[model samples]
Target: MMDAALQALKQYFGYDRFRTGQDQIISRILNGQDTVGIMPTGGGKSLCYQIPALLFPGVTLVISPLISLMKDQVDALKDVGIQATFINSSLTFSETNERLSAAAQGIYKLVYIAPERLEVSGFVRILEHMHVSLVAIDEAHCISQWGHDFRPSYRAIPAMIDRFARRPAVVALTATATPRVTTDIRKLFGIEAEGVVATGFARDNLNFQVVRGQSADVFLLDYLRKNRDQPGIVYAATRKEVDRLYARLTQQGLAVGRYHAGLSEKERAASQEQFLYDDLTVLVATNAFGMGINKSNVRFVIHYNMPRNIEAYYQEAGRAGRDGEKSDCILLFAPQDIRLQKFFIDQSDMDETLKQAEYHKLEQMIGYCHTETCLQAYILRYFGERNPSGCGHCGNCLDTREKTDVTVNAQKVLSCVKRLRERYGKIMVAKVLAGASEQKLRSLHLDRLPTYGIMKEQTQKQIGEFIDFLTAEQYLVQQGGAYPVLALAERSLPVLKGEARVLKKGHIRAERLAVDDALFEVLKQVRKTLAQKEFVPPYIIFSDQSLREMSARLPATDHDFLMIKGVGQQKLEKYGHAFMQAIAGYQAEQKNAVN
Candidate 1:
């Protein structure tokens, strides 16, 4: 079974070897063990089930959360000549029935279904007639209440599995899962000891940053202008922000698209299609975007606001650098983002316990934003994993921070908060310190305080940022309510008494991660043309990583081309000639120039 799975991997999926955790998960599944794979994004979780689906004698059932996700995976599978189909709300009743009929007739080697379909009697009855050798659950974290995106429909999966005549081997997969979530999935799936597989969550190719105290619009425009040619996503907190950023970027002459729930379905689809086709270099979206996106060449993912939790941010930011190239994952944070997230938590349907849990998670995200430690290590630790002492690739680890002693400045802010009796939020505090003549300040008689205007030289943004840093460092605490108040934490005493020094990272220009290679550009054009001709995503044809390898190696023969990482037997046969021709032409030109 292992050998056959490997053969299928080469022939169908176009890979030379299994990625970390895939081989173990696949082997465990092939041995008929209930398995749980907790892999990070870009960890090739699909191939674990896909390889076994080919090796299994009966059809493999894949339970996915989104139609777009199923369609993307099934389309990629069918492109490699695998028989795969998905049944979901996107299909008409007749179309769904026909596909179910095909599945029963053994027309598809794998069938993808949304978890909600498990509760449908008709869907279950149809599945009962088919031989399902394995059940693969994508986004399996949804089954646990502790998970970031819990779905009640996912809970029905166990009952659906019991309805099968012969219980198929179960394999649950998720990109982000805490130890609790991992245990929940295992218990839910009846996976036994040693049945869990996981890879490190740290993505070395990704450089993480938290860009606070900057104008999000100005900073975004500057970053985009510098990295204009790169494909990226800008994630905002709300649809209004998405639209606002979209309009601004569009007016600025950047090739940008927008995605959010407020947009018409057709508009969202069109925007997603444009981004997938490389027609749009920047996609400004809310958290609603990127759940099912499989685009591999995204060079950056910038969060306009910090997400409510680390899980969501990691998954969203993981969308970038999927091709194993260096990419930026930046969060343009503000203290108000905490309030925004709290507002969302308050509006949620979850009970008080769950809401409190969510708030705790939000606090963790806040900690991440305020942490001076390695960003990657902090994230890894959040996910219940560990990494080396220093990543050296993140904003903090880059050591480019211009540290300034803000001890005196910090005392003034803390003292100001105390003098006001901690009755206000960051903006008001910043304003009071900056001596902004606001009517509210006059009404409150805040200008009478001796601490007022002590830091008048600092801008509002700078003062707000100092408060955020203090809040993060526990020198100040932001109360959570309808209107948040600022209060001093126990740690504030040291700064107030001059017993401890306070330092903050000054503005450091982020290092641009663009690799300029003429040959790479030429190969990309060839890939684009081929993808257009074939009517597939360019990354599906060849990832940026593959193209870079091709450009570097300048493979002249089919055998040499096959040596490239992403080139499998089927892709080599389908695309070997054109790539070889391009490489040969470039090599000849270089030789001629040298002569």
Candidate 2:
């Protein structure tokens, strides 16, 4: 069965073999056992079922909530020369009837349908004559109310499963689902899926970056200029932002388009067509846009603001680097951005308690962002899966200096929060810690606390970083609404009680202090030397940014410098001589042999 599945993988998906968790999921499906796949986004969740859909004896009914995703999957299957058709609102009555008749006649191997379509009176009757080998539910997370992106319509799928006379094995796939949500999916589907494949949620191919203190305009423009001609998607939190970004990009001579729920179907389809064909280089869109895009060449995925949940972030970010190329996942963050989301949550129709719960969920997402450890690792750990080793590929790992034990700082910050009884948001707490004699601090009487100015030696940025560090470590999560509040996580009981040591520096990089002044002077020389050798601008050869990174890494060989990102062939070759000169000069001056 494994051999056959592997053959299908190569024959259709054009891969030599399955990715990390794909084979195991396919194996279980082929053995006729129910399975739940909790793979991360960009983790190849489709092949787990698609390969099995081919390996099985009869037709596979794929239940996909996103009509656009259904259409894309069916299109991909057809492109690979497999027999497939999807029944959705986009189909004409005649077209829909034709596909259903073909499924009745067993002409298609995979039949796609939205749950609403499947639950229609005559739809199951049409399916009754077909050979139903397996039931695969994509975006299976929607079956639960508590899921981050829930669709009440998905609850109708189990009825279709029971409608079939000869039972087909149930298979579920989702990029995001907590262990609790996973169990809910199993129980709701009437499947006892145990030890189901939940691949470690880590993408070593992506360099994860969460940049704070940057305005959206600055971040987007600088990022786009740095990576011109590359395919990427920029997700905005609102329709207004999308429109503004699209207009700005267009004015700057970029091929750009805007997508949102307000657009007409024809407009949406046209924008999507333009994007997929590479007629447009960038998509400034809201969250509703990516379900249909299966473009594998997207080199970057940037969020103009925070996503409401980790699941949504994973799904959007997963769209990049599908071809297994090196890619970037950048999140442009601001402290008030969370407050905007909190305001949205508070103004919703939900009652006070449920509204409060949703607000907390957003805060958890913010903490996830500031995490010093591997973003992928933190996400996977949150979903109740564990990796024995760090990913060693994400931003936290590849950053210039590994974060050091700031836990002591975090404890002090948390102490301040506790001392204030979770009354203040990050700003007020920051003021208190910096021992600000400002009028606001005096008014709040926060200056009187013994812990106030306890960390006076640290800069405000350092102290803010420590507090953000606590958010990342999850000892403290933003809480309440309006003014915004801070509260302890479920795991924070012991931390708050001082019984458990809070882990700091959620980063994977080993700590390396900044270079000594002598080394800095030598690096400056290296930059000047490289600038003269390369006929181009020195900044083009090696931006102060790139040089700073190299100085911190101290690459000993040409190969190491080449491996330093942004050292493309052009820069590497043109400036290689000067870089070599710098290394030689340093070695001679110090009388040390080259390592």
Candidate 3:
């Protein structure tokens, strides 16, 4: 069975070996044991069930959270020569029934359905008649209320599975699930605590970066100009910022698109399609974009503003380099971004407990922006990975800027926070430190403190940023929800007692992804033309990774073409001639030019 799985993997998906933990998950599912797979994005979670789906006697039901996800996965599955179909809100009633009837006839090896469909007795009744050998739950974290993106619809999944006369072996998979969310999912699904297969949450192919204290717009424009041909997503916190960035990039004549909830469905879908088809090189969107997006050529993901939490940031940023190529995850952060996130938390309808959780997450995100350690390690640590090693390519690890001893400056900030009774936030402390004669400060007599005006040489903005750095470094901690007060942490005692030193690095700048070869460009054009003819995204034809492989190997024969990593029998039969011909033509042209 394992050998068959391996053969199916290469014959259909074009991969010879399973990614780490993928084989384990697939073996468990094949053995009729329920499993939980916690792999990072582009970690081949889909293939765990997909390969099993091909080998199983009955159809594999994939319960996804989004309609777009369903469409994307189903389309990719079909391209891989697998019989797959999706039943979702996008389909008409008759169309849904037609697909369901097809599934009943065993026409599809995999059926992708939204979770909400399970709630409908009519749908459940239709599914009951089909032979379901496996049930794969994508984005399984949605079932946990503790997760960043929770959907109540996911809670209906276990019950839906129980309704079947013969319960299918269940597998839950997600790219971003913290230990808490993972535990919650295990409990709900009755998965054994030791049964979880986590491949760790580290994305070694992604270079993590956090850019602070710079003009975001200026830096973005500069960075875009450098990597103009690269496909990337710039995520803003709000629709307004998305619109602003979109307009600015458009005015600069960049091929960019925007996606947000504010746009009409048609507009959003059109923009998303344009992005997926590679008509646009950059997409400026809010968090609403890129969930379950299967496009594999994205080279970078930039955060125009700080995200509310690390999980949201990681998931959004993970969208880059899905093809397993090196990519950048850049965060452009500002102090106001924190306040803006806080404002959102304050205005949310969540109970105090949830709101507090959000605040705590936000604090961690701020730490991410300010921490001088390896950025990738920080994220892994956040997700509960123990003592994960740092990727030496992130902004902090690569930062060669001069370090200045800021211990005295940190002491002054801590002293100010302590003198204020640990009740004031950054702005108030900055004001008092800068000797601002605001009515609030004068009314509270905060100006009379010994630490007041001690940092008069620095601007209020500088003091505020220094305070943020102190908080991130653990010398000061932000307490309270919404409007948090600055309090000295245990680490502050040593700094105040002149036993600890604080060193701050200079500003870090963005770097460009590696440039592609000329042959790779030619192959991309071939892919674009083929995709246009087939009415599919270019990646649906061949990923950037595959194209690069082709360009490097310069395959000339059918046998050689099939040896390319992503080339399966179906893809070879369907697209072999065109790509092989293109490669031969390029070789001939190079020969002629040399002659």
Q: Candidate 2 regions off by >4 Å?
A: 193-195, 350-356, 387-389, 401-595
TM-score of each prediction: 0.92, 0.68, 0.87
Residue 416, model 1: lDDT of 90
lDDT of 1 by residue, 570-589 (tens): 78888889989988888889
Clashing pairs in 2: 372-506, 372-507, 373-506, 373-507, 402-509, 402-510, 479-485
Which is better, 1 or 3, measured by TM-score?
Answer: 1
lDDT of each: 0.88, 0.73, 0.89
Candidate 3 pairs with clashing backbones: none
Extract clashing residue pairs from model 1: none
> Per-residue lDDT tens digits of candidate 2, residues 169-270?
889998778877888998898777674688876777777778753345765776787666666899999998888888898888777888998889899888
Q: Write one digit per residue (lDDT tens) for candidate 3, span 29-90.
A: 99999999999999888899999999999899999988887888888888877899998888
On a 0 to 1 TM-score scale, where does candidate 2 land against the true structure? 0.68
Task: Identify the candidate with maximal lDDT.
Answer: 3
Candidate 3 Cα deviation (angstroms), residue 125: 1.6
Q: Over 4 Å off in model 1, which ranges?
A: 386-389, 415-489, 591-595
